[model samples]
Target chain A: DQQVKQNSPSLSVQEGRISILNCDYTNSMFDYFLWYKKYPAEGPTFLISISSIKDKNEDGRFTVFLNKSAKHLSLHIVPSQPGDSAVYFCAAGKGGSNYKLTFGKGTLLTVNP
Target chain B: GAGVSQSPSNKVTEKGKDVELRCDPISGHTALYWYRQSLGQGLEFLIYFQGNSAPDKSGLPSDRFSAERTGGSVSTLTIQRTQQEDSAVYLCASSSRAGLNTEAFFGQGTRLTVV
Candidate 1:
């Protein structure tokens, strides 16, 4: 079963504009969420993350909003740059099992110059 | 001084052959994990190891797949009697701790193809 889902396979946005990527999860046991960005021929790197205790977490130009009621979360990048183009994977894990994460298929985001 | 490093950047073997992929995690990171990414499977968790703890092998797909971490530093994933389904990029990751949702650093990955 697809516990974590990224419904959109691809997304496109203009540079310097705001970009939003969405993800949903079916597992209520998950209390922690993370977003990872990956470029071609590289591994996914952690971008930002949020805990279920808070509704939002922000760092610099990146902010992650969590809506526990909706079982959804989103990553927002302001003043998007061409370098932001990559595949983003949403991951979920509970405190147990040493935080073994379950990840989505990933969304390919393209920032146009 | 370094991040996770995986060796044999690429590997090709015939069916029923055996293959070994190695990973060197960042110094002092005690938690390690192995995952496989295939076109058909997307990405699947295979195994995990934490310092002096029994690995969680629940994600391992079959009896043909196995992994070992020695001295809590380097890990090796071994596949015996490989099948075409084993073709995929095998990735290794490490974190500073076992829990608390630590940020994981991934290796460049070893691409393994079973012909």
Candidate 2:
């Protein structure tokens, strides 16, 4: 009964290329979606987020797109650098219960030089 | 501290032993949360505490798990008679407030291994 799912276990991309990571969710009550990047031996850091009301949100090189109808979302990193390599976790939470986050298994992204 | 702090980065305890993990949230944060991450699995919510209200214990897996927050600041998670399945990285996080879409800052986590 996983409410969120990251179908791809891993993704690889060349330097300066665009890398896309996808995630899906089964719970319609989730109105807020967040992406967190985690390095080895460290806690996850917030990347970007999107509300169900918006289709897309962009910050610097990172962009997140959401499709409420499809119950899907994707993270895009343009000009991906080697530093961008890490595990990306997609988490969802309802507005009412913002403290509880349902996370996916996560997708490991590797950017090669 | 500038960020959430979790003590005992790693701990190994024998089966049936009790263990206590501690978490220190940011100075003014009013919300704290506990989560567990098993190998190859996603983060699982365990419990949450918000501004003096009754803590949400719904996510706690069993009676063996319990947590308490003192003075709305520090929090401690206690596991009684730990089992092998209790092994996991226990994480603590805090936000300015709860139910506001605020991002929670996390600690490095305490890795608990039950042998």
Candidate 2 residues A36-82, lDDT tens each?
A: 89898887778888888899999999999999999999999998999
In the range B1-115, model 1's lDDT, one tens digit per residue, is 4788999999999999999999999999988989888873446788999999899999899999999999999999999999998999999989897642446788889999998
Worst 10 residues of 2 chain A by lDDT: A92-101
TM-score of chain A of each: 0.96, 0.97
> TM-score of the candidate numbered 2?
0.95
lDDT string for model 1 (A31-81, tens) is 888888889888778888888899999988899999999999999999899
Give the least accurate 10-residue stretch of model 2 chain B, judged by summed lDDT: B97-106
The alpha-carbon interface RMSD of model 1 comes to: 2.8
Which DockQ-derived CAPRI band holds candidate 1? medium
CA deviation > 4 Å runs, candidate 1: A96-98, B40-42, B99-103
Residue pairs in steric clash, candidate 1? none
TM-score (2 decimals) of chain A in model 2: 0.97
- For model 1, the local distance difference test gives 0.88
lDDT of model 2 at position B68: 99
Q: Write the per-residue lDDT of candidate 2 for residues B9-101, one digit (tens) a residue.
A: 999999999999999999999999999999888899899999989999988999999999999999999999999999999999888967423
